[model samples]
Target: MKLLWLQGLACGGNTQSFLCAENPSVSEVLEGFEILFAPSITWDRYEEEVVFHVLKEEVELDVFILEGAVGDTRRICRRDFEDVVRELAHRARYVIALGNCAVFGNIPARYSREVKGLQFRFEKRGGFLGEGFTSRAGYPVINLSGCPAHPSWLSYVLLKILNGKRLELDDLGRPKELYAHLTHHGCTRNEYFEWKVEAEELGRKEGCLFYYFGCRGPMTHSSCNRILWNGVNSKTRAGMPCVGCTEYDFPRENMFKTEHAMGVPEELPLGVSKRGYILISGIAKTFAPERLKKRLIDEG
Candidate 1:
């Protein structure tokens, strides 16, 4: 497969994440595909010409992966990146939006009036590529969404595509295998969450972040805990809130503080009703285990 990776309004965090893949190893994974152009890995400006040529249909484009938001032409340079993206997307056999910015116009779109994602802007469809756009394979943009998408998720999707397997994407175009489960699944803080124990501050290692720290693990769709970031830990495991980075409405207000209504969280877990959450939480808190309430470490 001939792969071309392009970047628009981005910080290059996704490229860094891809470089850190461990299970299959970055080199091993790259060996499988023919990399036509990747600006981050190679400091070559002329590669854009090759991409331009590919867009013109002079060469076959097996896969076209876009990172970052598709900014407006007026605000940018003489060349319109969105135009190039639209053209290349139609020519490629497969189109993959490699991060939240590319898939949902993430942080960049928050302030920019003209920036948009490849296929969707936040939850709304009709972005740079429009809602009707589809790759030659008859598939919409395969979104690997995150602040900086997990390396494993990118590799997994690529492997599946290379093997000629049909992907099952969610309503937002994310692979079901990576986005079906909540970030809370397989989390180490499940006990504390169930018992409504709140972590007053960061790095306490004994309480759930949901109650006070605004962890969105229970509501966000991600395999962060199950697959583990860097094959060892997730944001919640490392004492940080989930932040719902994978969701379209990421970077929500008051990230450190959970929004509540009458002392109850405004957003409960996926299927748990407000009344049901209150009922279960009350019972669980009343019978909380003594072991879980105390600090895991002994400072004395």
Candidate 2:
């Protein structure tokens, strides 16, 4: 298997995460798979060699992984990333959409309606792959969504492929194994959330950032909290909100303003009804302790 990893209109956070993989390291799992290109790591090997410029008849790529928000225009590739992605999608045996930008028109597509994630544009509401696009291998695009995807998720997927385990994907094209867990699942701050104790401010140690800090742990789907980052903690655990970076609407209306409107988020939990959500929130709020509600300005 020859893997060709490409990028466009991105800060390359996915590449950074991929390099930080803990288990086998990217090289270990991708040992057998010849790397056609990987900008960060393969620069030593392919910097002088232009794989894309080579003759098509001389090239063979089995897996194509794209990490960035791509569109019909270009800041990197000669043509729009859409053309490059479409061409690669047709050529590769497996195509993986590497991050939120690649999977769902992340931040780059937020303001530029013309610019979009690989498959969909924000304004258009879908990608170049359209509503019914599948690879030649009969598999849909493999999506790993995140502002910067977790390294474990990427490594695990590659290992599964190497072991010949069939992958099961959700309707959104994300592997069920990784996206199955919500960001809130197994969160260390679950107790705070249950009690509806909103952290009065950042750096607090005893409250859920979701209520007032706009943590989207409840609605977003990802194993961020379950797996934990840097092996010890996650954003919520450190008093920062989840930011819902894994979901489509990251940097949503305002990056700093909490997502509460009249004391409630505009959106409810994943697949949760507003009525039920409000009821649960109410119950949790009632039981909040006075210490949690009090101004802890002097505590620290």
Q: Which regions of candidate 2 are displaced past 4 Å?
A: 53-55, 72-81, 122-126, 259-262, 289-300
- Write one digit per residue (lDDT tens) for candidate 2, span 155-206: 8887777677888988677789898888999877787788887777886777
Estimate candidate 1's alpha-carbon lDDT, on a 0 to 1 scale.
Answer: 0.87
Residues 229-285 of candidate 1: C-alpha lDDT, one tens digit per residue:
888999899889999999999879999788899988988888999999889999998
Each prediction's RMSD over C-alphas, in Å, is: 1.8, 3.0
Best by TM-score: 1
Q: Write down the TM-score of every candidate.
A: 0.95, 0.88
